[model samples]
Target: MKTVFITGSSRGLGLEFTKQYLEKGYLVIASCRTPEKAKALHDLKMQYSDTLSLIQLDVTKEKERDRAFDEINEVFDSIDILINNAGIISGDGKNLYNLGDVHKEDFMKVLEINSLAPLLMSEKFLPLLEKVTNAKIINMTSQNGSITQRTQGGKYSYCTSKAALNMITKILSNDLREKEITVLAIQPGWIQTDMGGVNAPLKPAEPISKIIELVETKEIADTGKFLTQEGKELPW
Candidate 1:
């Protein structure tokens, strides 16, 4: 079975990805900030004990990232897929998403978690990724990241963080091109999640299923593209 590593696997899209990937018979190393508190993930672990491995990983912490890397690497020789799904919407843990409303510290926190952490995780896990054939890195970005897609802007930090992530995705793609590793930034759409709000029309399952399909079928040609949940390319 192919081995995959996913960050932020406690709830929302991360949890859903863990469930589906386990069901599909993949060996999944799922990490969250608090594995003990992740009851749903625990339940899934019980159900798919053979295929799922749950670990504690606060992506922003370098020590935890390195520890998780060592632990995971000891068990699995190579990682076929790495899903950098961990991110934050608000810095102060509020709905203060607008430019004027959000504080500078909050904005920096968002950037650290959403933009910097992915790169850090990738850097730490490069050896394992390089060990695998046709390895892929999926950065969960947003359509709001697109410079051209912005019409009515308000989410300064969120938008900017994702935009930075998009750039990182491109850079990684170019750097890893010779290694034949595919790197992509994917917008999973506005779904009915905690960050997406309750009014979101799309649910977690729909977009996640589509995202998995895109991940499964992605090729070298698709690398460095900003793609929708349905695998359609979006403008940067």
Candidate 2:
């Protein structure tokens, strides 16, 4: 079975990805800030004991990232896919409202997780990815990242972070093209997750399912592109 590693697998889109991938028979290495507290992941672990492995990871910390890498390397020689799914909208006790309400520290914090962490995770796990053929790095970005798509302006922190992530995806794709590793920035659209809110037109399952299909069939030529859940290219 192909192996996949997912960050922030405790909840939201990450949790949904874990569930679907495990059901599809992939060996999943799921990481979160606290695996023990991840009731949903633990429940899945019970059902997919042999196929699932949960590790503790705070994506912002380099040492934790290193540790997770070493731990996974011990059991698996290579990973076929890496999903950079961890992200945040606001920092601890910091507001990310309109211009006057936004905090600089909060902006940096959002960028750190949504933008920097993915790049760091990709770099940290490059060795394992290199060992496999057609390896992929899937960064969970947002349509809000698209310069052409943005008409409103309140979500400064979240929007800017995802935009930075799009750039990282493009740069990584170019750098790793010779290595044959495809990198993509995918927009999940408005779904009924905590971040997406309750009135979203779609649910997590549908979009995530389409995303998995896109991931499974994407080609090297599709690398560096910003894409919707259906795999249509979006303007950066």
- 1-236 in candidate 2: lDDT tens per residue? 99999999998999999999999999999999988799999999999999999999999999999999999999999999999999887786444746888887888899999999999999999999999889999999999899888999788888899999999999999999999999999999888887777999998999999999999998787788899999999999
- List lDDT for all candidates, in order: 0.92, 0.93
lDDT of 2: 0.93
Q: lDDT tens digits, residues 62-106, model 1?
A: 999989998998899999999999999988778467966978888
Task: Give the Å error, residue 159, model 1.
Answer: 0.4
Instruction: Flag regions of model 1 displaced more than 4 Å.
Output: none
Model 2 reaches what TM-score against the true structure? 0.98
**Could you estimate the TM-score for every candidate?**
0.98, 0.98
